[model samples]
Target: MSDEYQTSGEYLHLLSEPAWQALRTPVALALRDAASDATLLDVGAGTGLGTEVLAAAVPDGDVVAVEPSPALRAVLLSRLAARPDLRRRVTVVAGDALGVDLPARLGAVLAMNMIGHLDPDGRRAFLRRVAERLAPGAPLVLNLQPPTEPTPVPFSVFGTVPVGHHTYEGGGSAEPSGPDAVTWRMRYRVLDADGTALREDHADYRWHVIPADALLTELTEAGLTGEVGPLDVVRAVRRT
Candidate 1:
């Protein structure tokens, strides 16, 4: 998890709904072979949307949702509390993927939109651990976002939605910050019905970029084999 989400986390749903909807079926289909009792690990489980998807995918199993951002965890906990079914199946844990206390054997793992938080070395180390822990034949599913290299992204409005008498708008831009990373500058704004800006918040965070070849190499070194599925999502499994 990136500290950058502390301020902008509240507005995540406005931008992520479509992605979540599109991901639900693909993720579930990927995990269809999971054991009935295995515990699913959801790294970077922001606000519990992905957690819900995992819980649904494995009706008889449990899900551990790991999120390091307190602000985001607060929302996640609230969502769990409100949904009795999820409350019974999902446990919210507070820590990043590397620091969180994970189960000894995981049925599967989901790392959507959060892999950039880990630098190159960290990602390799994390992959090795996941390879060791994931059940044989189980999958580690993640998505590689754009700007696969350290590249500049021009600012643009990414999302807008109405909320009562106000409209919330979110946008971001990124610039090369290092050989393998970019710094994202994000802005969230609230506008009155008449379109006057009511309030605005800004946040910045570093995102490590991993090219497909590099990621595949790391996966191979970690003892896992990976393939790009629908929507370019990577499904990596430990080699037999």
Candidate 2:
């Protein structure tokens, strides 16, 4: 499973206002204090929603926003360019979350919206590698919907949303591919206010499901003390 944000990046960054607003605050809340005073690895940092929060929290520290998708990285870089101050705190890079080399050991790891993209082995390996890169007792945050909930599907466009010059109509369906995998089909169309179509994209991807406790066990075996946080975020601390 590729952690590529290519298909959804532009939409999410530009006109997916409702979704972004819903995600930004909570994600930041989950990640804000996790990396205070230390360099952070915002793994799978799609367009930097979570990265922005983490960067702001650690004012003097640094963040290496490791993104695997060129489309997503472009949006993130543009934002960083617009805010010169963020360059001092956040450095966006294109690399695989599991395989990227780091400039420094991380005080925290933020993996959001991409865990389900990995297979079982990749999930376990990712936690292990995160443990290897973290400072002792640093946190590893995995943000997503709880695995126990039934997947959402056939979702209608949630009230047409307008963001800046673009209006978006988007929704999709998620079907269980198997006990561990779910296939999502999303279609989004961007239009100008005058009703001219700007661009449309369709994305179909598969994601695997691993229960929160199962993931915690994997982290524990990798030498981290782990638990599901109050908001369904997985929080683990590396063992010294």
Candidate 3:
């Protein structure tokens, strides 16, 4: 679960293309109306993918890229070395989303594909903390996978099972050598009370899905107005 493995330059390079493409447009549009002088935070900013996007959007503003993995932070630092303009505007911090104190009041907070990795309690606590840190009317954008119902597999045992049957053997399980081997991918959805589709926010989400209704309720309780947009994304803003 540690982010250390993600710091590889090869890995970071591989991710650059998709991460920029998926986040740039939506994020740019979201910040289009903000003043050029606004400040921003990119949470879980692995390898500066989202940070790069934010940098492009707010050239005259400041960006703080907070990442938990030291390895990834190293890569991010190296990447920033080449772009002097961005290097001046961006500050890289090594810290977890749940523990770090945001350095300044931010105009926008971007949490992309990072929520699900946290345990349930951590997720709720993080959201509440985000509400507290945001400036009045500031927007918090969270992209995560929706939880899906688990599929059940039925099995029956007519007689007592031997204890040795459950013991592991060195041989272990057999591997499928061919591409035809069956592989399953879980799909989830985020829906409002009226069954409207909310945009899917992240390509890789870590934890169990958070229901849309539950999200809205949490936002309301945190003193924010939650809006689930058409793209499976949720935008919550602090009340004015």
Candidate 4:
């Protein structure tokens, strides 16, 4: 592992499992209804939680799982390697949303907690790529979390999250970095039954948040018709 992400990679895949557990089912349902049995793209698929959902929702469909982080992708591939059924339905790729080539005309695209990693221009470019690769009327589901309230607020997101057989102990802090950005730093420790810390990880990220209306306009310009849904969701359909 590279020094940049070595310390951060251990739990980068496990820490988010709790949140994804709640969101994955609904996402699978949405994608299944949108265009099941078609190629689906799981952008920034992380540890492949979303891909697992997609696999179950559309058993006959294929998923292009893309993640840029090597550590995360390693976890993702390992997970998939254990599931031959899912492996048959998924093709894992290590690339960002903008750089990766579309494997096929996508029936749907699920991007969760990913766009915030991009700047304004990068976001636009990514949307443009989605537009280009999307089949007409295909859905592009986005999980765009709202920024934490109030600038310069002291924020600590901490919890003991259970995954499969083990637990993860993690906490995070974030501060407003700019009018449209936040600097978030987090650390985690994977624990065993005996309270032994098996491995530790950390990450620092700067998220760029664009306003809802502005994002809608950008999506519209990118040939997607969309509306904001409950819980910070932006569901868009490729224009025919």
Each model's RMSD to truth, in Å? 1.5, 3.1, 14.8, 3.1
Q: Kindly give the number of clashing pairs for every candidate.
A: 0, 0, 10, 0
Clashing pairs in 2: none
Pick by TM-score: which candidate is best? Answer: 1
* Model 1: residues with Cα > 4 Å off, grouped in runs: none
Q: By lDDT, who's the top model here?
A: 1
Write down the TM-score of every candidate: 0.95, 0.84, 0.68, 0.85
* lDDT, candidate 2, 1-240, per-residue tens: 363456776576655445656766655655544545567888888877777766765676778899888888888888888888887678877787667887467777888778887888888888878887777667788855534434656655644678788887776778878778878787788889898978878888888877777777788999898766655777788776
Which should have the higher TM-score, number 1 or number 4? 1
Ranking by lDDT: 1, 4, 2, 3
lDDT of 2 at 25: 61
- Which of 1 and 2 is ahead in lDDT? 1
lDDT of 1 by residue, 1-240 (tens): 347687898888766776778888887777666655678999999988888877777786888999988888888999899998889888888888788777989888989888899998899889988998889888898888879989999999987889899988999999999999999999999999999999999999899998888888899999999987787688899999
Candidate 4 C-alpha lDDT tens digits along 1-240? 233345666766656677776786557556645466468889988888877876666677878899888878888899999998888878988788888888567778989878888888899998988888777667788877756332453556556877766788877777888777887777787778877888877777788877788889999998888787756667888777
Worst 10 residues of 2 by lDDT: 143-152
**Residue-wise C-alpha lDDT for candidate 3, range 1-240, written one tens digit per residue:** 465344232334343444456656766555443334456888888777778767776677788888887777777898899999999889887787888877556767777767655665787787788777677666787764433222221222112111232311111111222221211222223334444444222122124456678778878888788776534566788877
Candidate 3 vs. truth: CA RMSD? 14.8
Clashes of 2: 0
- The global C-alpha lDDT for each of the candidates, from Candidate 1 onward, is 0.86, 0.74, 0.61, 0.77
